[model samples]
Target chain A: MKAKVTVRLKSGVLDPQGRAVQHAAESLGLQGIQEIRLGKVFDIELETTDETEIEKILETLATKILANPVMENYEWEIIQS
Target chain B: MKAKVTVRLKSGVLDPQGRAVQHAAESLGLQGIQEIRLGKVFDIELETTDETEIEKILETLATKILANPVMENYEWEIIQS
Candidate 1:
């Protein structure tokens, strides 16, 4: 199965990199951009086709190996099976 | 409109960070892992609701401001309008 996991900072979390990107974009003269929040995406390819196993593995990987529960929130979905 | 932009290294590009994560995950006793590719996500909020304008802005932002055309590919989608 193929899965995607996305991890992003919580709404109240500080995102300096995102701010920098926003500043840079604004400086580039692109108008109407109010905000830009950055995050991480993990595209995972696995051997298993079982949806249950994929979900369990993605959940564990997202929480334990990828995202920090305190400041970031994570979501994952199976794309191909 | 609210839009999302995802940028990832091209298929042939080297991704050291993703390799490190893969190694770390393997060492953590997690099985069935074949590959992990890392990417970046930008959640952007714009003031305009026009679809054509949003697309034009997003295309410019993704190519010129966010992604490196030599090594990375980017895709964007409108989430809300």
Candidate 2:
């Protein structure tokens, strides 16, 4: 089974990288770009096919290591392949 | 309009960050994780609603700024909200 985890900054959190990207967009003549937020994605290949176990493990991984509890939020999905 | 850009490392690239995360997962007692790859996601808000223009701009952004052509691959989608 394959799992994807997306970790993004929480609203109101300062994102300097996103701000820099926004400025770069403007400089590139792509105007009207209001906001840019940067995030991280993790693609994982699990050795097991048990749906319940996959879900449980992904949940733990997302919370424990993939995201900062105070500043970021994370979501995960199982991709059928 | 909103645009989502997903940038992923090309296959065969060495990802130390992913390896570290894999080790962390093992330490956390979550076994059976065969491989882990890390990537980036950019959530962008644009001031225009023109679909064609959005596509053009996003394509440029993805190639020139959002992704490293030699090591990463990128894909974008326009989101309707």
Candidate 3:
């Protein structure tokens, strides 16, 4: 199975990198870019073919290591490739 | 339109952060984690309702800012929410 996980700052959390990007965007003369939130993505390729198993693995990974539950949020999908 | 952008090291590109994460995973006794790659994701909220326009914007962002064309790869999806 192929999995892609994205971990991001929670809605109210502060993101310094995103802020830097936002500042850069402003400098580039781009307007209407009100906010920017940065996150991390992990792309994994595995041999498993079961969706349920992949989901379980992702759940454990997310809860244990992929995200800081208090300040971050994560979402993932099983890539079919 | 809302967009979620993910940028990562192209295959064969060296990633220090990914190496660090792999080391951390090994320290945690994770098995079968042969490799680890790290990427960035951006969750963007926009007031516009057009997907075509969002795609154009994302293309520009990916090429001009979100990724380093030489060694990085990027993909994005428009989020309905």
Candidate 4:
């Protein structure tokens, strides 16, 4: 099975990287941009194809290591191939 | 208007971060993982709602700022809200 996990900072958390990118865009003459937020995406492959196994693995990945629960939220989905 | 841009490393490029993550997962006793790759996501908001404007902006953002053409591939889509 293949899967994708997205981890993003919570609304109230400070995103200095995003702010820097916004400033860089402005410097390049890009206009009308109000905000930019950044996140991480992980593409994973597994040896097993069982749905139940995938679910358990994804939950553990997202909650335990992929995200900081206090400051970020994470979501995962299996990729159909 | 809002858009999301995903920037991922080209298939042939070495992804040390991904390897590190995989190793970490293994250290945590998670098994059956074959591979892991890392990517970036940008959530952007603009003042203009025009489709043409959004397209132009997204193209610029993905190509010029968010992704390095030589090493990464990027795709973007508008978020309906």
State the C-alpha lDDT per candidate.
0.93, 0.95, 0.79, 0.93
Candidate 2, position B50, lDDT: 96
Which residue pairs clash in candidate 3?
A: B1-B48
Residues A1-81 of candidate 3 have per-residue lDDT tens digits of: 678888888888889999888788678766666677899998766557778776876777777888999999889998897
> What's the ranking of the predictions by DockQ, best on top?
2, 1, 4, 3
Q: Which tens-of-lDDT digit does each residue in B1-78 have in candidate 2?
A: 998999999997999999999999999999999999999999999989999999999998999899999999999999
Interface RMSD of each: 0.6, 0.6, 1.9, 0.7
Model 2 alpha-carbon drift over 4 Å, by segment: none
Candidate number with greatest TM-score: 2
Task: Put the candidates in lDDT order, highest first.
Answer: 2, 4, 1, 3
lDDT of 3 by residue, B1-81 (tens): 678888989998998877777677567765455566888888776667778777877777778888998999898898887
TM-score winner, 2 or 4: 2
**Residue lDDT tens for model 4, A24-64:** 89998999999999999999999999989988988888888
TM-score, candidate 4, is: 0.98
Per-prediction DockQ: 0.92, 0.92, 0.55, 0.87
Candidate 1 chain B worst ten-residue window by lDDT: B21-30
Q: Candidate 2: TM of chain A? A: 0.97
Model 1: runs farther than 4 Å from truth? none
- Ten-residue stretch with the least lDDT total in model 3 chain B: B25-34
Each candidate's TM vs. the true structure? 0.97, 0.98, 0.85, 0.98
The worst-scoring run of ten residues by lDDT in candidate 3 chain A lies at A25-34
